[model samples]
Target: MKSNIIRSVLSATALGVLSSSAMAHGDEEHAKPRTFDASKVEATAFGQEGNPKKVSRVIHVGMSDHMRFSPATISVKRGETVKLVVRNDGQILHEMVLGTKEALKEHAELMKKFPEMEHADSNMAHVKPGKAGEIIWQFTKAGEFEFACLQPGHFEAGMVGKVLVK
Candidate 1:
């Protein structure tokens, strides 16, 4: 009788596990995959209407003929929205490329492959002299990133800034 009771309990435990696994499988069958609509996404300039100004820390990056960025070091909280307004005060085209240091290094190499490669994401922008551009980014991770100009040896010329997100 004692052995029979033990066997019954073991059978019940096995059945419970099997039932849960079956239920999980059923849930997967009923689950719907998430989809995104590209048309629903729109790009808005920073400080624009209809888009609430994110609690952003603004950084005014100025480029000059000597290939340099003013205020080369900036600090911000991790995950805080940042509004980087890049102004080219020089006579030539300049850009503000923001990314991880490694990413920027890789991008510099990729730029060699495609001379026209420009920052086209929501997190980066390119600007020309006498013109201004803005990039709204929220650094989700705490790390050191560099904002530089990949305009043909501009970075080597010292057109770079240190972005500390922490």
Candidate 2:
């Protein structure tokens, strides 16, 4: 009986979050997921690819409320194609945009200006509340990068993470 009550609460909470995020990205253009130009994203940055054999590892990331990402930092090998499976466990819209620290900072600023930015890039996976998304990309070079939610105030709220490709 106790477990049932808890499950009901959880379901309601998840529904509330999805509803809010849907409203935020209500326009069909923003709600529908689309792929963008990975070539222009940056050479050092991870780019999306379909090389399944190249995928050396699968990483599961969780985005939740309080502007947090579980396992804040991830590591990968150079020349490795990693599968990033990100899930939004919170009751809001969230995303994982991968890039260098500087690039992320710049992009975050741009997000503030264009809160409704739509994207479809291999290096980015935006998930709605209670939904899961994936990004399969190869780390072409060894370096540091970041992933964060570009949803309006999410980045500012500290929803960011680091990726170290060595």
Number of the top TM-score candidate: 2
Residue-wise lDDT of candidate 1 within 1-166, one digit each (tens)? Answer: 6446544644564455445533321112212322234454443212111121564577788888798888788887875776777888998777777766755665565455444432344545566568777766666667787888877677778788888877
Residue-level error in angstroms, candidate 1, position 164 = 0.9
Q: For this target, which candidate reaches the highest lDDT against the unseen true structure?
A: 2
Pick out the ten consecutive residues of candidate 2 with the lowest summed lDDT: 22-31
TM-score of 1: 0.65
Q: Per-residue lDDT tens digits of candidate 2, residues 1-166?
A: 6446544654564455445644343223333443444454445445445355567789999999889999799998878888889998998778888877766776676556546444455667778788888877788878887899877788888999988989
**Model 2 TM:** 0.73
In order, what is each prediction's RMSD in angstroms?
A: 19.3, 13.7
Whole-model lDDT per candidate: 0.62, 0.72
TM-score of each: 0.65, 0.73
How many clashing pairs per prediction, in order?
0, 4
lDDT of 1 at 127: 68
